[model samples]
Target: MPKLNYETVRYGDDPQVGASNAKQIFLLEELLRAIALQGYSFTTVTPLTHQRFLLGFDGLAKNTRDIFGWNLPFKATILPPYIFKIMTEADLLFNGGDCFRSKIRISSLGEDLFLHSHFPTNDSHAVFFGPDTYRFARFVRHSLRLFQLQSGFADRSIPIRVLDVGCGSGAGGIAVIRSLPIHQLYELNLNDLNFAALEYARVCANVAGIPVNVLHGDFFNIKNSQFDLIVSNPPYLNDPAARLYRDGGSLLGLELSLRIARHALGLLAPGGRFLLYTGMAITSDDNNPLLSELLPYLANDKFQWTYDEIDPDIFGEELKQSNYQNANRIAAVGLTVMRIT
Candidate 1:
């Protein structure tokens, strides 16, 4: 499969990325949000463990925890009748002859539960949330705190606008909004090419009661739109599947990161800022080409920037691939850029 090019993703409707499925996911998200209020939380794991946990349960979710946490099939008797009825009404409680399953998975970030695509997210429109989501959320929180202290909100009349470009599960934008004080007025714009992702994003925003303006298209497809803050945790690997959420395209999986950074610079509202969390490939020659490519844009006086490597080595498993044969390591990094007039 060819690597995904973010700039080229088409908008408009497609049959496969159906609305009915999105409605089903919304219902599922509502149900899971209720469960979340009951002190239910599941920290999702990698795909290997996701399968293994369900395998131990005979490939079926024997209880509520198993159902939400492992993405396993479940028998009708495993859940409360009302909850089962809700799932059934959503048209998602599928019966595979012997057992039933849901099309979405509910996981937690802190006490906040989220509905996302099921495990083994091999689909092109998969919306994923995991360890990286948690880290990205932290970075967002940190940035907000820094902004609050530095900017001092002296002018309450000024509107705060944010864009989560390439938002995949809406976690980044929603989490940032939720972290803000309730009295603050803000508008979050979530932009993504995947209809499924936008649907999930809407549901998440609804669950949080946060106002949002969702755009279904590539980054900045709206042209004149600008934001006070732009954030993303873009795909940063050369995934063989070319899954929309995993492949970052050429430059050793740094292409999308570079594109987003450059494009975002032009879309910021003067004092606007960008927080990008992505992984970088370190070659055998110990060169950081990704950073090198971005420096020219960041080096100018028009911007204030900082780069940090949060994880020096990640996805070590990907090294087995020929594309990564020359890579010495893969690191998760965060880049914060502020546009100054």
Candidate 2:
């Protein structure tokens, strides 16, 4: 993959960059508001499914969902005048010789909207949001509900410190913050290696009215003492293109997931909980490489953990790749580890 030229900034503090980012986010939020006013809603599917769906439709867009969610090419006249003006102002409208396309896609998670890269995300820094994102959000919400039921969980008044590792689009952290009780205080921290992802995350956070501290770096970049809750949904595919959002290194793409689990354990405070949602390659022999490696780490008395298969088979199409030749299927798995010393 080509190296991403990202200016390593903390919170995008530079005046010029901050101003430009502010304008871009403002326009994106405006666009999202306009879309919601029109009651537009769409759920993003896998890239393959999206392509298959597009094949059944005319290449041109017919509605807000078609133009923005399906990422179809549309003529300038297809959009309402106000929507067109916002896209133009935001510089998100791309001109083709005969048609116009959107530079980004907005996806819906219930009432919340998130901005991400357009379809066919072939770019090295594409911010991805799809089925995995939805699963991750659900896992976070479920975990928070369960956490609230724990003894003494409702008594403490101190704010919970939460972190989301490799928080693309800040979905996991944002979902956790959103699901919390209104009286419960929280400090949300999100970190990602992709600069473009961080930008979208910031915009998503702003639109949701959730305050967040964004960290830009590779895995394990944010140096904090500990967190009351940590969550992640990392990439687990062996992409030939080596896209940061898709490649999960070696070990049948479970390497990054394992590494994240280890790092999260060390940063979890006493009584803290870590929730991970990722894909695990299950071999023909029924061996799960990820759980095997993670079991040893949770053997200590201070930790209690549970692993559940969220989906028995996902990305079945990936079997065609030589990298996954030894694997029978990719399973979506969720791991929850609670520190209880």
Candidate 3:
């Protein structure tokens, strides 16, 4: 992936081509902010459930919330003229017959509104934000609270530096940044292999006024950088299409999660923490195979490791696929490891 030139990114001063793209992103952010101010709040649901809900509405969108929030299509006449104008100028709307749909989806997280790929996100570079995003936000808040409660974090010389691995929509880390007090300043890195995802992340971080260093590549490509915190909400499903955002590879979906945990350990500074929120596949023979494999890696006494099954069963629909035929079920799991020196 070609690197986005940092020097050419001064929107107000530079006439660079990238600046034009940046300007469009700014407009998109402004549009979303305005929508949020209008009390527009939505929580994204699963694609399956979203489809079912769309059916209940007779497949015709009634208002802005129906078109944008429910990811449904709406006739242009039904749209609020001003909102439609902004969507058109912001390049956020698509024509569906006489109806128009948003190119992106907006969801609310507290006071902030997050932008992500539109409904039925089947594209290779889809930026996903949904229920798991909420869970990851909770996990990050808890981890930061734990860090503050522990010793060594009190050292003012050390600022809170975080590396968000596979930051799909940059929601996990930016949410933390927004939650932290202004006095507790921090720098963050958003890492993702998907170029589109990184672009969306940059826009999200910019909208939040968060200072983010966007790293475009696989998480393992990361090196020579130690962070006070490393967090990941990695994709853990064995998709037949091997989608960049969803496929977890051939190990019954644990491949990418394990790989991230291994490399992330080296990137954690002393007293630093790693929080991995992912799904684990439990087979017929072994109940916690993923944890068993990960335990040996964190066996050292210096590391405080804890694993919790946040949800014992999720994505039961995945079991119908051949990749998960032998697997009993996929469970939502959280792995927290802190390097204490």
- The most accurate candidate by lDDT is 2
Candidate 3 Cα deviation (angstroms), residue 43: 1.0
Ranking by TM-score: 2, 3, 1
| Displacement of the residue 337 alpha carbon in candidate 1, Å | 0.7
In the predicted model 3, the residue pairs found to clash are: none
* Model 3 segments more than 4 A misplaced: 1-17, 78-82, 154-157
Q: Against the hidden reference, what TM-scores do the models get?
A: 0.89, 0.93, 0.90
Better of 1 and 3 by lDDT: 3
TM-score winner among the candidates?
Answer: 2
Kindly list the per-residue Cα lDDT of model 3 for residues 103-167, writing each as its tens digit.
Answer: 98888787667878888899977889888788889888877777677767645544688778899
Q: What does candidate 3 score on TM? A: 0.90
Candidate 2 matches the true fold with a TM-score of 0.93
Predictions in order: lDDT: 0.77, 0.84, 0.79
Query: In candidate 2, which residue ranges exceed 4 Å CA deviation?
Result: 1-12, 154-156
